[model samples]
Target: MDLESHRFISYFLPDQRPELCHSATIEKFPPGTVIFEENEKPDALYLVLDGKIEFSKRGGLGQYQNVAWAEENDFFGEFGVLDGQPRSARAVTCTSATIAKIPRDRLMDILERSPGKVVLQLFHHIIHYLRLTTEQYVNQMVHKHKMMAVGEMANTIIHDLKSPFTGISLANSMLKDLHQDEETQEWCNLIQAQITQMVVMTEEILEFTRGKATLNQKTFNLGESLEKFQRLNFIYWNQHNINFILRCDNIILNGDENKLMRVWQNLVGNAVEALDEQGGQIVLIAAKLGQDALIKISDSGPGIPEAIQSRLFDPFVTYGKRGGTGLGTAIALSIVEAHGGDITFESQAGKGTTFYIRLPLC
Candidate 1:
């Protein structure tokens, strides 16, 4: 082999036998060729002699994202070889490339024969790679935790500020109605309603942040509560041109009325927002399924993307034009879990989505 093509030998001891290097072979690949794929065995070490290689993985929703790249003289597959594990990523050639392949057995033989220099070099490389990987992981975790803490703090501050805001907005609406003409009063009413809605939304978010929102264990008529929730929010839904459908016989569930009210509110509110100005249908159904009470909510708006459906209940994951705070479903999940119930959903892009809630009956 040419001295330049045998550059990997520099990592070995000066007195090491040259037989190991002589056993290696140089191979060439064309652009778009897959050098290795994730989960494949790493039986040989590949040292790039020329051109570029891209490392990527299949992400959520079956998408591929390039996470790293390698260039001339860079070594690939070393990490898999040292750890005795399958390949962690897929590598593809970005351009026509030349690579030197060293068989694992031959490499091990050279390392065993030249203990000091080979061990020292291997140790240095392994330690450096591990340190970098650990740092990257830690940084990501820290950033996530920080964002959660900030969201919690904001929820608390907003809660405290909303009470006075609600009172002021209400009083302003009354005052404007008494002192202004019909047109001005109408605009004032719109502003007041918006402020009040904001106040209610803030309180709901605060309840979610505290992680204490749950149905109170009390015997309440599920049918009646559903009716009240619909009646209260009917104007809002109607104004948005969202058709609401309720199909449930008088069924009773032992739960908190206020907390369950919030659950329906959030789910229905989400459905309404998803409908956009194009108009869509929201269906709410309650039925007896085995020994549990089943509540199903479905909507006709564009459905949740597959990329985010798995993480939909996770805090800070949102979809739609409203750019949600990502707490609604998280709070809904927490509340349902607290009630000894469970929630699930099925969705397809451009079609629609449906959420199912199952709770044990008292």
Candidate 2:
């Protein structure tokens, strides 16, 4: 059951030419054509002679979620016939395709014959494929959970090390105060800087549960950032009848401003998509709270689904969004968290949502 060589099924059943003439009919389809849909009764199995076919399943929000694909010479649709069940996935033409459709009766007849080894091989191949798919998914889940566990361990380790780091910093400060010698002061400053950098670096990696990354530590101040966002998104908000508002306290923060900008833009974009044509209001507020910069983006729209709220920042977690990769919030969390910040949200079904962000201020 080599997918690429499934056209060989004809040789075992009948001569390829006669098989097409009597046992099967050759059909052509254009790209994006739906060959079959999930749960549909199987009437015919197909052998792709040319071009490509894709298979997808309906995801949580009724979105098309890709599962597998078939291409030239790949035969499919035998599952339903063999099990006397409906199709479990949707199949569509990915490109203009030439396919040979074998009737259900023809396939069943082959299974009854003595030389049904090819069909048996095909079953073995598909079962093996399904087993591999399940294994991969299980492995992925295991790895995700493992990373989360490791992240917890990292947090504990960092916390334990913090006391010693604090002591070192305090001692260094005392030395700087006691030793007024210029050369000694310079050496103390260098030591203090390196020690502070190490603590900051440790804090930065504590939230990298998914993996690792480098964050730029450049410092800059945002002046009326909320106003700037409102200006840029005014038309978009107006077009959607979404009232936009802005408030700012212009706080300075250290990080790659460009990346932070992208994060803000993505959050706002997510809000727009969450909202309907009935429109709503989006308010962006920025200020300073003690040593941290505080930003809150509130949207008056349908709130995030509770099913995915807890794992909202996990990759591929999405609800209400069509064709969304679900990486927007996850990436936003990563960027903000790596800067020793936190992003949290409060959402209630019909009441809308508010996302709060806290980042260290320079």
Top of the candidates by TM-score: 1
Q: State each model's CA lDDT, in order.
A: 0.77, 0.75
TM-score of 2: 0.44
Q: Which ten residues in a row have the lowest lDDT in candidate 2?
A: 1-10
lDDT of each residue in 166-284, candidate 2, tens digit only: 89989998999999999888778667755654554344445456476567668676654445445555667788888887777868777876567656876887888889678888888
Candidate achieving the largest lDDT? 1
Q: For residues 147-226, could you state the per-residue lDDT of candidate 1 as single tens digits? A: 56755876776868777887788788688958778877766765665564565555556666555553448998888878
Q: Give the Å error, residue 60, model 1.
A: 35
Off by over 4 Å in 1: 1-204, 207-215
Any runs in candidate 2 off by more than 4 Å, and if so which?
1-211
